[model samples]
Target: MEETRPAPADLRGYCGNCFGLCCVALPFARSADFAFDKPAGTPCRNLLADHTCGIHTELRRRGFAGCTVYDCLGAGQKVSQVVFEGRDGGRRMHEVFPVVRQLHELLTYLTEALALPAARPVHAELREALDRTDALTRGTPEELTALDVGAHRQAVARLLFEASELTRAKVRGRKKRHRGADLMGARLKGADLRGADLRGAYLIAADLTGADLRSADLIGADLRDADLGGADLTGALFLTQPQVDAARGNAGTRLPGSVGRPVHWAAGG
Candidate 1:
């Protein structure tokens, strides 16, 4: 029998174990995404000393809507505990935060790859890649800081692309092809997007209300402020917690099991 791989924890940010890295280490511009401008290495005004968001319950209402969609993919805790030894007062972790986040994101992709039945032919390769990435996450602060994550990401991305092809190989139809298209602000409410190829689509603020997105490939799609209320996203590929968080959804919205309903979602949203 094949070894039973342990089910992965929520790939989303575990803020309790995190040192609020996103709130401090990353800068934000005053644009549609962020409500205010913030310089790197400075904590957000809403971040409490305990590393919790003071306005967590009302981040959107308080005009900090961008924070609602950011997930560190468990990199925050890894950087906090492993890299900094839970010290939480070091610039080294901050400097390497982006790379570590990328590694964790790769791990998330590999983990999902292992779960896809159609990708079973490449399961061994996926497992090996996941193991390597898991090892990288445990690397020392110096090793992580000096890592070339872009090259590594390219290598892993090739494997992920293969996995995506294998998974969607049987999805035959006159599917819509919108890869990397600028669909921002498009009024796509009730759109029929089943089995569509929407990879890397700029869906920022696109109204996807009641859209049928079953089996749609949404990898790298920017869903920021996209309305997904009452939308059917069953079996949507490459849908992440952050993307779901960025969209407007209601109780009737269908999401993948890997992600939970966003706290900010309402019954009527």
Candidate 2:
């Protein structure tokens, strides 16, 4: 099959060319997010032979809500169709997947950083990092498994922080600093959160209608059911698919280029 290259920010899980790596390679602990514990290296019972999920449509109803938050950032296809092209699934396939998954996640952010107009000062560095990361993704499975991902992440992280500062600096007025705050169910409507250091903040069910979140570092922030109506999230750092999927947003909410509009947003969920 011909590989149709998608835009960098549009990277997503293409399960067709994947061997259901997310279902098998990653372990799931039994919790509200997941109904039952699933060990790593074991395929879920719902995974079909053709690499499709049998209970895909009824995942939430069947207590597999954790699957909805996952986004491989196109790593699954890269692993299945590139690294292990001539080989079949084995212990190696499962082992290398986690590493590649992290690499692709970084790529997702780096790709968006390149597209940010305010982040132009670091575009060259971002491009260099992107190239290096892309090269690493194409490395052999052994190399991927052995990669120093922590070191690479630290290097790229500085560039991303610089880019965030550049973008958030454009926002007028004082910026809010809510880093790691327990703001659960807090009403922050129309608040100015530009360049806010909200990393690891607990925003579960918070009301942020029409809030300005530009360039806020949302790494590890819990946004479950947070109202984001008309909020501006352009250049928001470390925002992920799962966070967006869990949040409440309408057509008016502006998101970063890296993520797509959640299906639930369109259906008026």
Q: What lDDT, from 0 to 1, does candidate 2 have?
A: 0.84
Least accurate 10 contiguous residues by lDDT in model 2: 1-10
Please give the RMSD of candidate 2 to the true structure: 3.7
User: Could you tell me every candidate's TM-score relative to the true structure?
Assistant: 0.91, 0.87
The residue ranges of model 1 lying beyond 4 angstroms of the native Cα positions read 1-7
Query: What's the CA error at residue 223 for candidate 1, in Å?
Result: 0.8
| Cα RMSD (angstroms) for every candidate in the order listed | 2.2, 3.7
Task: Give the alpha carbon lDDT tens digit for every residue of 1-269 in model 1.
Answer: 46433246635578988888998899999876678999998888888989999888887677877787788988898888777788865677788787788988888888888888998988888888887887877888889888888888888878887787787776776778898999999999999988788889999889999999987889889998789988999888888988898888998799988788987786344
What overall lDDT, based on C-alpha atoms, would model 1 receive against the true structure? Answer: 0.83
For model 2, how does the per-residue alpha-carbon lDDT over 1-269 read when each residue is reduced to its tens digit?
A: 33223376336888877888998899999987688888999988888988799998887778876788677888888888888984655789999888888888788778767777999999888888988988888889889989999999999988987887787788777778787899999999998888898878999999999998887879778998899999999878879888998888999999987678887687663
Candidate 2: where are CA atoms >4 Å away?
1-6, 234-238, 256-258, 266-268
